[model samples]
Target chain A: MAENLQDKAHELAKALRESDEFQALQALHEEVEEDDVASRMLSNFRKVQLDLQDKQMQGEQPTEEEISQAQKQFEMVQQHDVISRLMEEEQRMSTVIGDMNKIITEPLESLYGTPEDEQNQ
Target chain B: MAENLQDKAHELAKALRESDEFQALQALHEEVEEDDVASRMLSNFRKVQLDLQDKQMQGEQPTEEEISQAQKQFEMVQQHDVISRLMEEEQRMSTVIGDMNKIITEPLESLYGTPEDEQNQ
Candidate 1:
């Protein structure tokens, strides 16, 4: 509950925002959004992702056809110049967040033990 | 990607672990685990949660009766002294992580605007 811990967290966030990956991600994302063709392509890709998420939330499986459709939309978006670079940078940023999450949750993992730790027994 | 940014992230995590909320959560969690009655109650509560999660992954919703059973077990666990306190500390820790996530994703938010920001337009 220390206030400084929260402040440190925010500072790390600011540093990440200033990182090259984040800067590129923001710039490319903006460029894609501003381009009519790229925006439509990205919009289509986002629609498929949201549709799958909605179905999962409703406790329904996405159909095989639906999955294939989504894959096609993803590939189409990836063909865009700015969209492709944005996705690459997005992956890098996601990795940063994932790493942060693992580190942040280490205390909980130590208390309960990881699922991987259980499997080794 | 700055190495310092990642190093800073790990440092923030270390700070969080050293915080009072995390310390209390860990101690209480272990105390609950070592108590036979509390352990068993917690086990039952966890089992229901895992079962519901499994069902959801398989695209099946929990029935009303199943939901009621899970709720009953949750209430029962809350009746325990250490369990209740542990849950309270867990909430606090979760809030810390949630706040971190919001801050960490600010760059993305700036790029795309928040979902709330979109709704207001």
Candidate 2:
């Protein structure tokens, strides 16, 4: 039964890959990667973002200035055509993946309840 | 590029499905399904859970008794071997899916900035 479920999961993965959302996201990623300027900008943005995340995870809030600087940089990156389109595609792909996850976890929801249940109790 | 990214996502999904965690989850799901008592209990639990979730989504808090009743029912369900195993498997599978989602969204993270950025600003 486990093996069979594994097979089903694999099948679901295949279907997800074949989805238009994934295809669009992949295409946009490639387009962004090919552009040196956009690629460089994205890398820098990610570095700052990760740093901020690490700080937050450690219970440190980013300074106001740091937050402002990050937001400005983000907006600058979004100004790029390839970057903007890639972001859109990424969002679509995320939604698709989220839906898939919901389906996969439906059985579990039955057994243990949901986050709301935990919170309500 | 989109096609390639899709391929990578598919590969990640395949790896996830084949993982020990996923196999365990799949095995437990089958085990629960095969037991009539456990299966019926799960079905009822899910219906109640969904209703609760719907109400919460509408900004309604369940009454104290409702919350207590649901918790009691959940605990009863958990006492069953198949149900408990299934719950454990579900958590494991959810973790795997979460990790996969993180990986899949990493590129997007690099592009649009993190959620913390939005919150900070």
Candidate 3:
């Protein structure tokens, strides 16, 4: 029974991963919660974009100090406290939603079960 | 938005608690998991039942020592270690099941969502 339960758990996990619902939730989640890791990843991209915009506006080269400051800011944002909180919330929401599903399905089977069986010894 | 989210959480909880599935699951659970707290509560009841059954078979009254021994055994069973694990498993299973439902439902919306909108800022 324990082995069967474990197998069921794996099957369930696979079904969830391939599910359209999982994809949709993941997409929606991407919008709702931004990752510090990814945001940190794109720091260089942001710096390049900012540098380009600055050059376009001022027609002046950015100083080494300015570039250094921007890098520091990018690093700080990458590990921002808010980003950490968002990650936590993301994890919590996932657990909450999963629990809600179980609440919906498995519990109902007993209501329709026979009364004699209900009084199991 | 926080208030709305809180309200939704409450609604979800209420829906789950009152659900037919919840009732059925509760019943089924009663059969599978014997709680130590309740078992302790019914310790006296068990002693009475055993004493009555023994008297019927042996056609002899149970001695005070026999009753006391039975009570001690009942008390020990009431707080068995296995009951605690069952309680833990019950909680874990509830969370797992709820998570599965969310995986099944919310994620699908993104698969059907527009590609343009998918690239949200």
Say which candidate scores most in lDDT: 1
- Report lDDT (Cα) of residue B106, candidate 1: 78
Q: B18, model 1: CA deviation in Å?
A: 1.5
Worst window of 10 by summed lDDT in candidate 1 chain B:
B1-10
When 1 and 3 are scored with TM-score, the better candidate is 1
Instruction: Give the per-residue Cα lDDT of candidate 3 at A78.
Output: 47
Give the per-prediction TM-score of chain B.
0.87, 0.85, 0.32
> How close to the true structure is residue A5 of candidate 2, measured as C-alpha lDDT?
46
Candidate 2, which segments miss by more than 4 Å at Cα?
A: A117-121, B1-121
Clashing pairs in 1: none
Question: What is the C-alpha local distance difference test score of candidate 2?
Answer: 0.71
User: Please, what are the lDDT tens digits per residue for candidate 1 over residues B64-121?
Assistant: 9999999999999889898889889889988877887787777778877899998998
Q: How far is candidate 1 from the true structure (C-alpha RMSD, Å)?
A: 2.7
Off by over 4 Å in 3: A1-121, B29-96, B99-121
| Highest-TM-score candidate | 1
* Candidate 3 per-residue lDDT over residues B1-121, each given as its tens digit: 1333334434444455554445444654575446656555444545577676878576577788877877776565447555444445556556655553444443344433544565783
